[model samples]
Target: MEETYLSAYVFKYGLEKALKKTGNIEEVTSRMIRDVSGGVRVEDDISPEGLIWIDGDNFNTWLKPKIGQCQADGSFKTVYQAAEHVAPDPYSIYPSSGKCTADGLVGADGKVRKNVI
Candidate 1:
């Protein structure tokens, strides 16, 4: 597959917070869903270093708490609590060239301390 470079911003508070603050989540999510479904091509645009232009829907999904109050009091504290389903899998992904590191996977959002190269 051809490589795609997305503008990235892996924030400590989480990308969803940034998206909500920017008021771009709805627009970004729409575009991302289309792209992931192969219905549209993702656009190349300028994004802040800590912010990445990727599948918004996937990122949104990744940010949600998997366990919620039902499973645990504060399961939402970390992404790993729901890594199996919450983390971005097929969308909002990193460059295929990035390697696995102690941080889990370099360049992958919400996984490492240094998310971008």
Candidate 2:
């Protein structure tokens, strides 16, 4: 008997499609093997962290929600709210009074505070 392995490009294409369909590549990939008879194994040589860099700057908006304010106790707070208005110039040092502060406040010790709002 001979064995064949799927190429990285093919796997990536399948993964992208699965992610688009389920919105979760990891979960979908896991489920796919579970549903198979021989217990198909897919090698994920791609670093989980590296996935963030795939699209780089173009993915900034998609990654923004994941980047949040860290609290002094190491907890995170959501930077944007569904109901609140997002600032047009979040990076501007002198933002408009009504704009939300994009940068989370960090203490002198590099710890974030819970009272950021």
Candidate 3:
């Protein structure tokens, strides 16, 4: 969907701008631009019809819970809300194994406050 791409663009733009404040202005900005542009190109190359299948299947699998209470009045409440918002820290980005592990770059208010020792 166009909205999804637009949101990603806006988010990356803001994220890159924020990264500039941490030094390496040129490197960070250029790498972010290239990576985001490449991702967009790949997404754009997918046929619109392909999106129908991908999005349809993804919606059925992921969003089915949200629509469980649809009534004759066309109203429903959000039953499932994610308890945490996790975003990868750009400074320590790296690929991990299939186990979905991270290198301690995720930040949360309470998580940040905790100390191991």
Candidate 4:
């Protein structure tokens, strides 16, 4: 009912122009990730690094050997850049081998807190 900036843009420029946001990837991502969780503000520092996918399909631990300091640096560079968000299979074939019996989802056992003693 109300004519917003988006509608005006679509009428003036076209749907594609209105629907798309154009900006540098790092700046865009920094804008996107700005918020606080718990007591820590989770905003990303402005940098030129784009989002990268580290292939960790067979690792025994989820984050054992360290990983991607990723960003959304260059998604619009090419159509294939869309694959940055696509994650590979995140489960090891042997789920019960390398660690405790905790299945990896958060709150898996219906308990909110898993006390580490």
114 Cα displacement, candidate 3 (Å): 34
Worst 10 residues of 3 by lDDT: 54-63
What clash pairs does model 4 have?
50-71, 50-73, 51-71
lDDT of 4 at 50: 34
Tens-digit lDDT string for candidate 4 (1-117): 222522332233322232344434333332232211111111123112332222222211111122444458832332133423443343235442233322332334444334533
C-alpha root-mean-square deviation, candidate 4: 17.2
Per-residue CA lDDT of model 2 for 15-88, tens digit only, reads: 56566667765568654522221212233363321121112111111111234699999877767534432323
Clashing pairs in 1: 7-52, 8-51, 8-52, 9-50, 9-51, 9-52
Over 6-41, each residue of candidate 1 has an lDDT whose tens digit, in order, gives 312223223455455556865545433333431122
lDDT per residue for candidate 3 within 1-117, as digits (tens), equals 744754454446545654655556545554454333322211234432112111111111111112245668886555664443223223333322111112222344323322322
Candidate 3, residue 95: Cα displacement in angstroms equals 17
Q: Which stretches of model 1 miss by more than 4 angstroms?
A: 1-33, 36-60, 71-86, 90-117
Candidate 2, residue 88: how far the Cα is off, in Å: 54
Worst 10 residues of 4 by lDDT: 35-44
Candidate No. with top lDDT: 2
User: What TM-score do all the candidates reach, one by one?
Assistant: 0.15, 0.21, 0.25, 0.19
How much is 63 displaced in model 2, in angstroms? 38
TM-score (C-alpha) between model 4 and the true structure: 0.19
